[model samples]
Target chain A: MLKKRIIPCLDVKNGRVVKGTNFVDIRDAGDPVDLAKHYDKAGADELVFLDITASHEKRDTMIEVVRQTARDVYIPFTVGGGIKSIDDMRAILRAGADKVSINTPAILNKELITKGAEIFGSQCIVVAIDAKAKGDGSYEAYINGGRVNTGIDVFSWAKEVEKLGAGEILLTSMDRDGTKDGYDLELTRQVSELVGIPVIASGGVGSLEHLYEGLVKGKASAALAASIFHYGTYSVAEAKRFLIDKGVKVRW
Target chain B: MIGIIDYGRGNMSSVEAALKKSGYKFVNTDDIGILATCDGYILPGVGAFKDGMEDLAKRGLDAFLKEVAKTDKPVLGICLGMQLLFDYGEEHGGAKGLGLIKGQVKKLTTSFKIPHMGWNSLELKRESSLLSGIVSGDDFYFVHSFKVVPDDDSVVVATCEYGEEIVAVVECGKIFGAQFHPEKSSDKGLKIINNFGKLVERC
Candidate 1:
């Protein structure tokens, strides 16, 4: 059976993790390597380090951070944020990142996704979509930390991205993000049903039941949370234990 | 000294860095003479089976590996390198392996996921020095779609359930192959590497 994964996402800037209430008013979390090691020790299925400011910076400092983290922690680590070209993907992978998540660049140039999959194999590329629920009950694709709206339908875009060779979809719900109400179950289920690749539910998750809901109801292969994990509200081992008690096959 | 085969796959620096940090003397080379002189060999590989096999053939390391296997010298294959130890693989149509072990690498047919990329626990099946300090149910990092099905199941050291029981580690005398990358696994991963380093000293 495929075990459901619990991932803690870290947004790194200038080598330190910074968290925000709603992707703004950033506060320093800690060193990425330290946080990553802690997560690894806590039994996190995987760790995601997003260089939120990769495009603004001239050099990719995340590579060094990833290298350091990979040395210290044994779990798989994924790097996202800027990742525009194949060279960026190559450099990160060479730096010891197990997977590379692409967001803005993939939406801008669809070919980059296919190229990444072709050169590095589909398993290495992850397409992260920041989706915002609209007033009409539809979702729109947002990029640059939800600052820019691509005006593309989230469901259509996810299907297209899958067709473009995205190994997995890291779907983030901007509306429910940091709300802690729980994941947008309906949105997650819709996307997961549309795409064949593994869907990692991101953005809104408050408790162990939310993670279970993401896996069981939302049909997400994994659940990623930031505030809950970053604030130490719940450890991955505890979450996995709860999920296991609920009969969810989690890697415990 | 440990010899880590470098055939332009991916991430040889980190592997070398890990070995060096662990206080083990090692070199990354494809040259047969230099590789053969090493106390033990660590075959590390990434990317497709076809490309990896082509690079091994181009460097004439294929026959040399067969000779090393015959000597029963300690050799460890990580990730794609581990896949190459089998008799054949179904990646990119089909490719020939090093034939050190009697097995074939086939794509995972699980509806769960394709890559199976993340941290998963191992279920130890047999006892061996390669897993001396490792415990059953210890999680290890895995990132591959294809797994080895050994002709002789007794050779399997550990297995991980991913829709099916996939062979995680296989040991036949001095030759060992881990489908997961120990250099990339973390603490348990380092312990496995340390065990291999000790094997080098014994050799």
Candidate 2:
């Protein structure tokens, strides 16, 4: 049986971790590589660095961060946000990051998904979708940090990406984000069932229960959280122990 | 020293880093001469079996690896690299493998999931040095769509369940293959790599 994965996402800005991290033992909490190494020690299954860098000139910093992390960390890690082209994907993967998640670019040029899959293999190409439920019970895909709505149906776009050779889907509920509420179970379960590829349930994950809910109730293959892990709410090992006690198979 | 084969396919960085952390000296090389110089070889890959085989052949590594497989020196294949050790595979219209191991790589026919991604615990079939210091049911990270079907069940030293008994580790007289990415599998994974390193050192 495949074990459910717990991924800690780090938001990067100008080569530094943007979100406030509360790991006291870490000398430089803002350092993505150090925090990544810290997370690996804490037993994180994988790590994701969402580069929210404003300037393109500073983008190389993220690559450097990825290079250092890959050199130091043994577990798999992913670099997302601001990745727009095949060349960008190449630089990141070449830096030793196991996978790269694309959102805006995937929505803008769906062909990138197919091309990345063809070039780098589908296992490395992850299509992340930011979804917001509409009043009519339909969810709409958003781009630009959920600021601009693409007006594309989340479900249909997910199916399209899978057809285009995306290996996994990182589904984030815009409505649930930052609420500390929980994952959009209906959104995650429906999408997980809708596609054959693994679905990583992201967004509103406030507690271990939420993570468990996302894995069991939402039917997501993996659960991703940032604040809960960063703010010292729960260690990855603790979360795994909790999941294990609840009978959810997770890597210790 | 171990030679990490670079065949123009798959993830080589993680293997290099893992070996380095395992305190083993290694070189990333495609040169058959350099690979021959190494005490052991680690074939790490993450891609299609057909592509992997084609890459090895294009680089003339297919023959070189086949030659190495006959020797006492260890040749550890990871993920797609492991599949390439098999005689044949059903991936991408079917393609011939390195034929080092008596097995065929076939698509996993399980209702659980395709690409059986993430961590899964191993079930020990028998005692082997590859799993030294590792407990039964120790979790190892795996990410693949196909599984190898060994011609002889005795070749299989370890198996993991994902709706069925999926081959995890196989050791046939020094030619070892791990369907999981031991490098990406964290501590226990590093231990396995170190065990292989120790085997190579012994040689």
Error of 2 at B59 (Å): 1.1
Tens-digit lDDT string for candidate 2 (A164-225): 98989999998887678999999999999999999999988889999999999999999999
What are the lDDT scores of the predictions, listed in order? Answer: 0.86, 0.89
> What level of docking quality does candidate 1 show?
acceptable
RMSD of 2: 2.8
- Candidate 2: regions farther than 4 A off: A20-29, A54-57
Q: A22-133 in candidate 1: lDDT tens per residue? A: 6878888898999988987787878899898888885457888988886777677789988889999998988888789999999999999999988887878899999998
Clashing pairs in 1: A1-B163, A74-B185, A74-B186
Each candidate's number of clashing pairs is 3, 1
Instruction: Pick the TM-score winner.
Output: 2
